[model samples]
Target: MTDTAHALAASHTLWELVGRRAELTPDRPVLLQGDRRLTFGELRGRAERVAAGLYGMGVRPGTVVAWQLPTRIETALLSFALARLGAVQSPVIPFYRHREVGFALRASRAEFFAVPGVWRGFDHTEMARALGAKGVFEAYDDLPDGDPSVLPAPPADGTAVRWVYWTSGTTSDPKGVLHTDRSLIAGGSCLAHALRLSADDVGSMAFPYAHIAGPDYTVMLLLYGFPAVLFEHFALPAALDEYRRHGVTVAGGSTAFYSMFLAEQRRRPGAKVIPTLRLLAGGGAPKPPELYHRVVREMGVQLTHGYGMTEVPMITMGSPDDTAENLATTEGRPPEGMRIRIVDGEVRLRGEAVCQGYLDPAQTAQAFDEEGFLRTGDLGRLTDSGHLVLTGRLKDVIIRKGENISAREIEDLLHRHPAVGDAAVIGLPDAERGERVCAVVEQPPGAPALTLPAVTEYLRGEGLSVHKLPEQLEVVDALPRNETLRKVLKYRLRERFSA
Candidate 1:
């Protein structure tokens, strides 16, 4: 690990690490948004001022402040300022409406709620007011600022619960996952060490800053003293110009991001998508080995995928130095402190990086096992080399003819098909077979249409068992995705195709 990374790993809190990095590399760039830049020194100074401003607004230590804003320099500044004040922060995704946003605000009991006023043609400030949110204010173009001298002493303890991150809540109300500064710092440290990044490496954040990944990625920048391009709105072709302009060495948010880049590369064959991009890495959804091989083979860049959730920002991450087979096939090994225990094929994690638990006591109790490992609810096995190969989720298994089949197993094989752009395997209710396997796919533009028989033949050729073959196939213009990382919403697929 680099000296800075070592220092960061030893630091107790996020603000402490940021301050230390600023002291060491005060002039180094920390954040880049279009033509504007913020250095380490300026980040700390501005955050302190914002901290004073928030403090003046009665945001004392332990105050719950929820902000739903886009990914920008001001958002980062506000988040760090909240950290500086030791306030409990719950960040809602900018695209979320009353259902998710109101749940988060009420659950967190936020004393102050910051919105972007009107963003993407939605009136968030008005919605906040309608929800009866306390201390609602706009924090898009301008953030709160005041004299730093009026602020109280920065919190010294890093173990206190100061962050409440929400789950996607696809099937139910989102859970407020509790976290502390030390846990977030540890998560970031794991990412920094696993990726083998350097100060010269330029990164990019194309996802929502309100997600747990916000702190996870920020921790890496402070540790490595590197800057990452921030994209408030990310899309292909249009976002490609900024990636190339910034010379982003590392880019990607999830499996969807990899597919988007690959699609762009396919559009202009024989030309590099982003001339300077050397690595594409992220986690939040499953990555097919075929996708990894295609990225490395076609894009001429290494692709390292990982395993993480809102409960744990990072669990395992493939390293660039690892063997290609391992990098392509498995989620990389855990760091020194992360303990991965597979109990009955369920992946359980115990580490400082793991979240404390949920805000509700009952949910917290149900989340951890007797030994204190966070029950990941994910089914996976550890290889002899300590790599994690995730199978289907416990709830994602299909039971056809009283036989169990893995959806991920089928999806991975389907990705190998030339006509398949992306695939989501779901099980619909069936009377005779218990639950029937269904394949929903998005084909590449201008590619031959895919049918159920053709998909079955391809899967059979790929060595899939008869029972696991998808009984139904649905081809759509695109797969349904959430706003956060564009993860395939299988529940939405089930809702659409169940009938």
Candidate 2:
């Protein structure tokens, strides 16, 4: 972190940081969408107006306000407005439907609900009404505006829990992850410092703003005084023009985003997909080492993957200065304040960036150890040089005949095959082996079909242990993925192929 950013990081709250950044670079652009651009000065001034507007609607400090809005500039404004008021805000992913939305609203006990009314052919306002949401209001393109003079003093305590983020909930109901302004600022500071980004670099947010990454990525921009283009609805080829128009220098949301860009580059081999794109960086799901090499070799950009989740939005991140071996095989290193402890192969963390806890006290008790480190449930080891090497999830480990096997190990090897585009390895119910290894794969376009024998042979050739070899193979046209960061839904695969 630079001396300026280090000074800015000392700000007590998000609103304080916003005020500081605006003072430093008031005229600099902070957000860009389509033809609209918001400067640091505008962000601060407009957010205060919006805060006063919410105050008029009975929203005060600590009020639980839930919003299910898209990735629009307005969404960021409203969120910052709430921050200025010190109101507890719960942001719902725009793609979530009735079940997920209702769960978040009820779990947070939201007093006011914000929606985009009707977005992309869905009636969110109507659904909010059906769910009996309190204080339902629309906050899409038009926001409530009032005199900044009427607003209360900005929040001073950054440690107060003011944000509630939701888990992806691929297999079950989403859990509301509690976070404070300082925690979010810490998370974003770590990321910005790790990536070594500067004000000259332009970033892009292709994921949903409701995702924890919204604050994670936003803080990076605020700290560096750079602008990121917001994609309300992001899709490849369709969203390519905006990236080009804004000259996006850093672009990526996760491993899936890297694949999307790589596929686009393959369509036109020699030409750069986005001429201004210089780096691909993100982390939410597992990143195969082979994917990193292919991205560097084919797309001609530095690919830096990280490790994070809703509980800790920025854990470890690969740096451009790191060695290729470390970049390809490890998930970078944690920042100075972040501590990584491995207990029984589980990666536990303790840091200011880590979320306070879940909404439920029981869940919070179960998530942490007596030492106060948050149990990540991920299996990983710290390298001699401090880089994190995640092997697999504790739940993802397949036990066969009383022997433990890492599905990630098999999946990583499978990705090396020319025919395999993506793969998800799961354990299936088998009376013989207790649990059988199942390889579910999606073949790249124009690749040959793969069978069980062929997959097993490939694994054998890669020197995989006999016990870890997949017993069955299932090929599909496309892998099921969550809409936000495009993480593969492995639980869905288990349910689909178990029978």
Q: Considering every candidate listed, which one attains the maximal lDDT?
A: 2
lDDT of 1 by residue, 258-363 (tens): 9889989988889898999999999999999999999999999999999899999999999999999999889999998999999998999999999999989999
lDDT of 2: 0.95
- Estimate, for each residue in 1-499, the C-alpha lDDT of model 2 and write its tens digit: 7889888887889999999999999999999999999999999999999999999999999999999999999999999999999999999999999999999999999999999999999999999999999999999989998898988788899999999999977668888899999999999999998999999999999999999999999998888899999999999899999999999999999999999999999998998999999999999999999999999999999999999999999999999999999999999999989999999999999999999999999999999999999999999999999999999999999999999999999999999999999999999989889999999999998898898998898889999999899988999999999999999888999899888
Report how far residue 289 has shifted in candidate 1, in Å. 0.6
CA RMSD, predictions in order: 0.9, 0.7
- Lowest lDDT block of 10, candidate 2: 167-176
**Ten-residue segment with the worst summed lDDT in candidate 1?**
1-10
Indicate the residue-level lDDT of 277 in model 1: 95
Q: Which parts of model 2 have CA positions greater than 4 angstroms off?
A: none
